[model samples]
Target: MQFDNIRGFLFDLDGVITDTAALHAKAWAGICQRLGIPWTDALAEGTKGVSRMDSLEVILKSVNRQDEFTMAQKAQMATEKNDRYQELITHLTASDILPGMKDFITDLKQHNYQLALASASRNAPTVLKYLGLSDVFPKIVDPSNLTKGKPDPEIYQHAAALLNLEPGQCIGVEDAPAGVASIKAAGAIAVGIGDAHDLAQADVVFPGTASLTLTALRGKLEDGVLNA
Candidate 1:
């Protein structure tokens, strides 16, 4: 909205820029099946916008199995899931980028807005490369060393810092509640790309990437502030 003060943009990887959310779900489903954990849409949704380990914990705790695995076992499971996810993403191409996202990025760059990837995925760079967007976002927040993930402001804050901008000067685009919460916690505008009711906390909500445009975003502002 308005975005007069926004100098940069922080983006999540999965549902925001690409359709890899389905790939991630498929990987997790494989893990669940192997572990005999009942998989459901609710469990899959819980993994959105979170780190791999956090998602694993979510699945484990769903059935009171969190304490069953040792650190090494959990690590192995995570690795397996990532391996599957990576294999699934091997077919990705520029055509897989969400509708209108590339154009939106171009518009933002044309307007001199800095951008960075703030995804929880450690494979963010690889995914970007596959999408032919490696140069589009040179600064991707390193998830490996982050002390906290989405729903904590650390990742968004780190992304803003990478751009040499304050959190309030950036817009965070997310398709999950955790990511929206993180952006809001970081004192940035939260732009949700999903169901309005699901992302009720966002400063503004759009149904999908196809609706993400500077003019449309600005039109959502009321007195220079976003109207959710």
Candidate 2:
């Protein structure tokens, strides 16, 4: 099956476009330690595409310490994580673009599909700026504008709206299950490009974007257009 006539494409950052999830994990764990909170990779992965406040809620709950942290403490902890995340990303260059992503993004633009940044990352602007691809996307909807986070479709829906395209006329590329659910729930095609277990909700799955040549993605884009 192919996704044809896709008027726009939404791409997630972090693990999708940057090899920075590990950095985020490191930062998050560091913040947890300062606050005497336990950290687990599963919690971090589970909350992968959520916003700061939402992620904090998940982490606190995961460690069975949600009730112990006051709102003020949570805010402080979230800020610490953001600061750490920013420090880690401040020096990332365009050389850090994910495998085949630069080529894939170039091919999509060559085909004239609209490109947008639709990520749960509140630091999308900083990260994009650091990567030197800030101008690559015409639309950007970070986590701040949405009341609900991924697995709820708010971010994807916002991106499609920003492009003035029907949800069916847009598609989302993501590496997390929550992100895949967000795209599908928003009525757009979802392409999962990462570990299968992490993207089980996606309509189509690939081992990694390295295997996703332009020809392959364009085929899927064509299908979305046809179906739209």
Candidate 3:
């Protein structure tokens, strides 16, 4: 399906541009260990594309301890997890950027497409700076002071607004189901980067970043080849 009307692009950070999801999983596991909660890869996957506190709530729910923790306690735990994630992300370099991401971004820039980041990570700025991509995205809609997270659509809507474009004029790229849902809810074309089953709600799904090409994307958009 083509989205020839698309004028801008909104991207989710972790799995889309880099591989920081594992770092987040590790930090969350450490927090679970300290809290004496059972953690697994499945549980870690639940946190993808969500805010720190939201992820904490999911973790607490998994262990049936959500009702037991006071708001203050939950906040403290979230802070602890963020601290750990922050430390781990400090080790990230441009080398951590996913294959084909840099070239794709450069191509988009050369084509004069507006680029914005719509990630749930509050540490997005730090990671972008570490990757030397601080200036690539002129606008970033992060979790700081955000009340609603994906699959809420507020982040993507905000990103489109910041780009001075309507949601329908932007293509939102994500690797998480929640993010795909969010973008679709925002009336934007969702280009998902993950397993087909995981991103069935998206307008189109690609196996990975390396397989996506600017020419193909443009053709899809211009040719109106999208699924209804």
Best by TM-score: 1
Query: Rank by TM-score, descending?
Result: 1, 3, 2
lDDT of 1: 0.93
**Which of the two candidates, 1 or 3, achieves a greater lDDT against the reference?**
1
Candidate 2 ranges beyond 4 A from true positions: 220-228
lDDT for residue 102 in candidate 2, whole number 0-100: 91
Q: Candidate 2 lDDT, tens digit per residue, 11-98?
A: 8897778878887888888877876777886877866877888888888887688899789988988898889989998879999998
Q: In angstroms, how far off is 136's CA in candidate 3?
A: 0.3
Ordering by lDDT: 1, 3, 2
> Best candidate, lDDT-wise?
1
Model 1 weakest 10-residue run by lDDT: 219-228
CA lDDT, candidate 2, residue 148: 88
Q: Supply the TM-score for candidate 3.
A: 0.96
Per-model C-alpha lDDT, please? Answer: 0.93, 0.82, 0.89
lDDT of 1 by residue, 1-228 (tens): 345888999999899999898999999999999999998999989998899999999999999999999999999999999999999998999999999999999999999899999999999999999999999999999999799988999999999999999999999999999999999999999999999899999988999999999878877764454535
